[model samples]
Target: MKAIREARGIGLRRLAEAIGIDPGYLSRIENGQQGAGNGTLHRYAEELNVPIKAITHEETPRDQE
Candidate 1:
């Protein structure tokens, strides 16, 4: 997610504003400290020009097993 964002040259503030979220909240989501709701996820995917799967496929600690 962060990789794609950086590759697209999208700033945190820009993406957050596009997705109607707080920049700090978006940072938390990027850091895995918070989860984004489905609608929010869709907005982010659209803003980043990526599929929802790209953002949703994050490997949680449990998924490592």
Candidate 2:
């Protein structure tokens, strides 16, 4: 998350505005003090112009054949 945001030269305040979240919450996310749900995560990806898959890169795999 930090990497992508930094890559785009976006500040936490701008990202929060783009994602409709609070800057404090976004800061918590960046500092690893909080975690966001799927909906927020997707919105972050969209606002940051990155693939959803990239944002969810650490998602656990489902059990399947």
Candidate 3:
């Protein structure tokens, strides 16, 4: 996510503002400290001009096993 954003010449604050999220939260998401919901992921992918899969891979919850 950070890679795509940087490639697009966008700063964290700018992308977060564009997506209506807090920059610190976005940073956490980017750093993998938190997970983003589908809607937020879609927004990020759309803003980065990339497919949603590029940012996220569907996963089975460990607890489901």
lDDT of each: 0.90, 0.86, 0.89
Ranked by TM-score from best down, the candidates are 1, 3, 2
Question: lDDT tens digits, residues 4-39, model 1?
Answer: 899999999999999999999999998889988999
The clash count for each model shown is: 0, 0, 0
> In model 2, which runs have C-alpha deviations exceeding 4 angstroms?
59-65
Q: Give the per-residue lDDT of model 3 (tens digit) for 1-64.
A: 8888898999999999999999999999999999888888999999999977778855457636
Candidate 1 stretches greater than 4 Å from native: 58-65
TM-score of each: 0.84, 0.79, 0.84
Q: Give the per-residue Cα lDDT of candidate 3 at 59.
A: 48
User: Per-residue alpha-carbon lDDT of model 2 for 1-65, expressed as tens digits?
Assistant: 88899999998898899889999998898778999888899999998888887866765465232
> How far is 22's C-alpha from truth in model 1 (Å)?
0.3
lDDT for residue 49 in candidate 1, whole number 0-100: 84
Candidate 1, number of clashes: 0
* Candidate 1: worst-modelled 10 consecutive residues by lDDT: 54-63
